[model samples]
Target: MADILFQHEPLIRLGAFAGAFAAMALWELASPRRRQAIGRSVRWPGNLGVVVLDSLLVRLLFPTAAVGVALLAERHDWGLFAALSAPTWLAVVASVILLDLAIYLQHVMFHAVPALWRLHRMHHADLEFDTTTGVRFHPVEILLSMLLKLAAVAALGAPPVAVLVFEVVLNASSLFNHGNVRIPAGLDRALRWLVVTPDMHRVHHSVVPRETNSNFGFNLPWWDRLFGTYRAQPEAGHDAMTIGIEQFRDPRELRLDRMLLQPWRSDAGRYPIGRREPGG
Candidate 1:
């Protein structure tokens, strides 16, 4: 199973991404949670462009990707799980959970560190939140994230199948949690206990710095709650809350070129986690 998954990793990931993106797009059109001031025409081109660039760059830089690293680790019996002689089922489950936690920590670090925030802030800089917003990360940030995942896979001796599952599920959850579509309040409340809901994740994109610092989890909801970074809702409420950061309020920043240039263009601004004013 691991060999088959390793051989077909790209196709499996592409199919999953396409299916999830299409589903979320349709759902957004059908029942949007909030009215979009900016249409997809302006955002999708740049947002989608970033995903293409990030994917191509990852393939170019890390041909084997995380699954390949996992396979190598497994072959050599490397890392904690291998050393422990853990059962396959336990290893897979624990690896997935730990990988998710790593991502959660990475997200928080991006906000807390001034330099990293410069790269990650691009994702939060989207003027509108939607499924495309989920994929709108700066290329540098994506590369750094891939490097981290590779290290984590090797260190954990994560099974190739588990790495593949984590990659696919993380992609799907990013799209799902960033969806502009509405869920019934009751359903959203129930769903967030198991996974991060769109409403829960959207708070992280709120213009307010403190709100921006909260709800950093992309795949699992537990880490935010565990670390006490969870915010139930934007203070201004989701419908009325401003999106994007203070520096790039101009819609021109939505262009592909501008997004690529964002990290270099401005100072990290006041959004870096510890920059809050005394009263704030």
Candidate 2:
């Protein structure tokens, strides 16, 4: 039962795939003009495929290293994995939060390293903010992130159940931030203190390079808020802010081939990718 549940958890989140689709479709209807201009341009199915590929690869390879590290760390008390202490539900919740914290660090590394930035930029290349856009990542970035988390999982000796829960929440949050669904002002403001919401994430995708550098937290917004990278659009609407690389404002450059090669292009006029953020 645990195996079956873990296997499909990626397909079922708090906001399931179907739910995210409905939310996005609703946003598309409500804000037809703004969404249609860029949001409509994205290919949803292709992005979903990326998620499937990345998830499967990690799940298959992840267990070996994760289990190995847990075994190695068991020798030392502080380095050992957490034993199941609370109810199953509580353990899972704790796992998800811990894993999200780990993700925050890995995200920062992607922006700080030039080589990694080249690949990670593919995620930022999307002009659209839709559910499926979350899965749009350079293959290299996905592999590196998986490895980083593997080490974290080992060092912390996180429980298996928690790991399972963490993967589901991580996948869901990825979709949440990238999705185009509208967030109500009051709730959005409140949620920002906990998880990284669509509003917080929208800033990370801004066309302006400076604003894009802030808000690197994955599942939690406080990571950014605490780290001092959090920035929200002031006095106005995310409605006015645009998504995509600063130089690659052109929608065509958002395609897979162009985004994959974005770093190589010397001309920001042609590509529009920006310099790395200070202390990124």
Candidate 3:
């Protein structure tokens, strides 16, 4: 099963991405949670452009990605799980859990660190929250994230199957949780306990820094709850609260060129921790 999954990794990833994206997009059109702050024409192209670029660059730089690294580790008897002689199922489970935790922590660091936040803020700068917004990370940030995932896989000795499952699930979850579609309140309440739902993640995109800093988990909700960063809802209420950072509200900023240039632009004091107060 693992060998088959690994052999067809690219096809699996592409299919999952396409299916999830189409589902969320159709759901948004059917019953959008919020009126789009920017039209799909303006936002979708740029957001999509970044993901394309990131995918190309990552394939060029790390041909194998994290899954390949895991396979390599297994062959050489490298990494923690391999070294510990863990069972296959145990290693896979532990790998997924640990990888999710690592991502949660990495998200916190991106918001907390000034330099990294410059790259990461491009994601938060989307004038709206939707499925496309989930994929709108800067290429540099995406590259750095891939590097981090590779390192984590190496250290954990994660199974190749675990890495594939983690990647696919994380990708699908990002699209699902960042969607602008609405879920019934009762269902949302129960669903969020098991996974990070759209409502849960929307809080993290709130324009207010405090709300933006909360609910950083992409796949699992437990990390935020465990770390005391889980905010139930935006203080101003989800419908009334603004999305995007305070700094870049202009529609032109939503263009692919401007997004590519975001990291080098002035700080805008958009970062959450130890803010320097915009030219202070």
Least accurate stretch of 10 residues (summed lDDT) in model 2? 266-275
Writing each residue's lDDT as its tens digit, candidate 1 over 123-200 gives 999999999999999999999999999999989999888999999999999999999989999999999899999999
lDDT of each: 0.94, 0.65, 0.91
Question: What TM-score would each prediction reach against the true structure?
Answer: 0.99, 0.76, 0.96
- Per-residue C-alpha lDDT of model 2 across residues 68-172, encoded as one tens digit per residue: 443344434323334533455664566567778788877777776667677777787776777667778866678787778777776666655567556656666
- List pairs with backbone clashes in candidate 2: 81-157, 247-272, 248-271, 248-272
Top-scoring candidate (lDDT): 1
lDDT of 3 by residue, 1-280 (tens): 6567678898999999999999999999999998875799989899999999989998899888888898888888889998899999999999999999999999999989889999999999999999999999998998999989999999998999999999999999999999999899999999999999999999999988888889999998999999999999999988998999987789999999999998899774856566644455
* Best of the two (1, 3) by TM-score: 1
Best by TM-score: 1
Error of 2 at 214 (Å): 0.9
- Displacement of the residue 250 alpha carbon in candidate 1, Å: 0.7
